[model samples]
Target: MVVGLGPGSPDWTTPEVREALNAATDLVGYTTYIDRVPPRPGQHRHASDNRVESERAAMALDLAKRGARVVVVSSGDPGVFAMAAAVLEESADPQWQDVPVRVLPGLTAANAVASRVGAPLGHDYAMISLSDRLKPWEVVAQRLSAVAAADMAIAIYNPASSQRTWQVGAMRDLLLEHRKPDTPVVLGRDVGGPTESVRVVSLVDLDPADVDMRTLLIIGASTTAAVDTPTGTRVYTSRRYHRR
Candidate 1:
């Protein structure tokens, strides 16, 4: 089974996922995600580096074949840039074909971040990862340009990290080509966790230095708007579109 922990918050974790965790005899995941779950009396954890997803999936399958109720835990919804795909890919192996796999949904980071604000994703949106480790930067740039030209809101994941920092600034520049300078961009860092911070800025004002691996960016479309209320500033994209 694959379980989602939901953006590092216990409150965000689903009841079904919690039940699966409790029932699991073994847990397999990236070290950080595995550490997020409190250690149980008898549950064995197989934690690995985040880069070694294929090996981690194989480990889970091996344990499951040996009569262990294994659960692979991911930070957000496993189906969205998480372990579910990795596990499924590994399960295609002839050796693990007989092992049954199941996935449980959890709140995605994009949705969690959008909720913190008003509803930046209320209308049509596209989710893209800026990571070039697996794919070339050209492909990432092509997708970003296509989405920007389509006037669709964007939920950007893996914008930057210690080793990869230029993508965010480049992304901002590319979006500027199609989106207005004043387009709303929400920066959510460590959202739902103890160090959570969410702020709204214009596309031109988005600083690459402010982003990291823990950050998720929501770049709104032309129909998106930010307004101040008695409570705080709320950002949302209009559901009703005006033909341009």
Candidate 2:
């Protein structure tokens, strides 16, 4: 099954995902995602590094090829920037074509963070991963500029790491061209887990030095609005598509 695993918190694991784990003969996922599952008796684990997608999918396919039931794990809804895509990509091989693959949805970091900070994605939004390892920086910048100019709420993934210091600052600068410097920014780190932390601040006050691989940043568009309600200030990224 392709389980979302939901934001790394046990509470986010849906009953369906738990059932998949309990019945699995083998588990395949990144180390951190595998750690979240703990150890169930009689279950074998195949953990890989952050770099190996094809190898991980091959491992799951082999286990299932040998007639073992396997649960491929991923953090946060697997389909959203996670392992589910890799599994499907590899499953297209004729050798594993007949294997029955089930995908279970878990809460993705974006949803988890958005929930905590009111509705930043309440209307239209775009999710962009700032990792230049897989994408060219020029392309990343173009997308950032276009989306920011389009006034869509942007959820940035893989914002900053020790090795990738400048993406966040570059992104901030790009957005500043189209968005107010004081626009609200939501930084969600290690969300939905024990180390979970969240902060809401303005773009001008955002410090790139505070970001890491575990952080997810939500940047509201220039046109984004916040209205005080009984519950809290609700934020929305406007969608001109709905305007008549």
Candidate 3:
């Protein structure tokens, strides 16, 4: 079973995920996600580093083939830039062909962060990962330029990390070509975690330094609007478009 733990907050974890964790004989995942599983007296935990995702999947497959009820955990929805793809890639191995793999969904960061602010994604939007780990930087740049030109809201995942720090700034500069400097942008860090924070700033004012691996950036489309009331700020995109 591959389960999504839902953004580090127990409140976001679905009942299905909780039941899977409870029934798991062996739990395998990155250290942080494995730590979220509630401890069971006889359960075995296999915690690996963030970088060795394929190895972790292989370990889980081995345990499963040996008749252990193994559960693999991902921080958010497993299918979205997480372990599901890795597990699927490894599933192609003939030795693990008969393994019964199951994927459970959870709240992904894009929609989670969008809810915290407002319905900024009410219109067409593009979800892209800025981590060039698996893809080339030039391809990422071209997509950003096209998305900006098409006037679609963009949800940027894996915006910045300790190792690769320049991409976010480069993305900001590229978007400026097709978007105005005053376009609204949102930076959500550790959403649903204890230190959760969401800030709305102009495209020109978005600071790359303020973002890290835990952050998700939402860039508004041309039709997005922000309103400030006594309660706080609310951002939304009109469902209908009007010709100017």
Candidate 4:
């Protein structure tokens, strides 16, 4: 079963998701996401290194081929920018073709970050992965520029890592081309677990040095504005508003 974990908060975990996790004989996921699941005895675990989708998919397929009821977990909804794509792409392997593959939906990192930053995604928005580790940086830059030109709030995933540091800055510069310097930016790290961190900043204040693999950046659109109220100064991307 694939579980959509609804971000990293414990209460965000759905009852059915917990039951599925408990029922599984084996768990397979990226090391970071796998670590968030509470440790349960008697379940075998196979953790994958970063960016090893093919290997993880093959391993999970192997266990499932042997008739083990394995749970392939993705942090958010399995289908969103996560392992579900890897699993499906690799499922073409002859031995794995007919195996039953179930996908359980979890809250995506985008939704998690969006919630913390008000309704920035309340209107049409785009989610892009700035990590060019797998895709060409030029392609990523083009998309960034396009999204900026179109004025959509963009949820950027995998912004930077030890080896992929420059892309985030490049994305920032690209967005800056069509966006004002003060656009609201939301940075989320470890969204649902004990170590989670969420920060709201402006585009001009975003320091690329602060990013790591665990962080996600949400860049609000031109119409997105900060409002001062008794609760505090809040930034919102209005669902009731859009620009042509």
Collision count of model 4:
8
True-vs-predicted CA distance for residue 162, candidate 4, Å: 1.6
Q: Which one wins on lDDT? A: 1
Model 2 TM-score? 0.90
Deviating ranges (above 4 Å) for candidate 3: none
The per-residue C-alpha lDDT of model 2 at residue 200 equals 74
- For each of the candidates, give the backbone clash count: 0, 7, 0, 8
Worst 10 residues of 1 by lDDT: 47-56
lDDT of 1 at 102: 100
lDDT of 3 by residue, 1-244 (tens): 8999998589999999999999999999888888877788999998888567788889999999999999998998999999998898898899999999999999888888888889888899999999998899999999999999998999999998899899989999999998889788888899988899998999999888999999999998889887777766777877788553
Instruction: Return the top candidate by TM-score.
Output: 1
lDDT of 4 by residue, 1-244 (tens): 5666767786777788788888899999877667877888888888777658888888888898898988888777788778788887888878787777777777788887777657778877988888776789889888888888888889998898888888777787778889899888988898767788877788988899988988989888988887767765566787776545
Pairs with backbone N, CA or C atoms under 3 Å apart (clashes), candidate 2: 1-102, 2-102, 2-103, 2-104, 4-78, 4-106, 6-107
Where model 1 places Cα greater than 4 Å from the true spot, the runs are none
Give one digit per residue, the lDDT tens place, for model 2 in 10-115: 9988889988899988998888888988798889988877758877887898888889998888888888877888889999999898888878887789988988
* Model 3 clashing residue pairs (backbone): none
TM-score of each: 0.98, 0.90, 0.96, 0.92
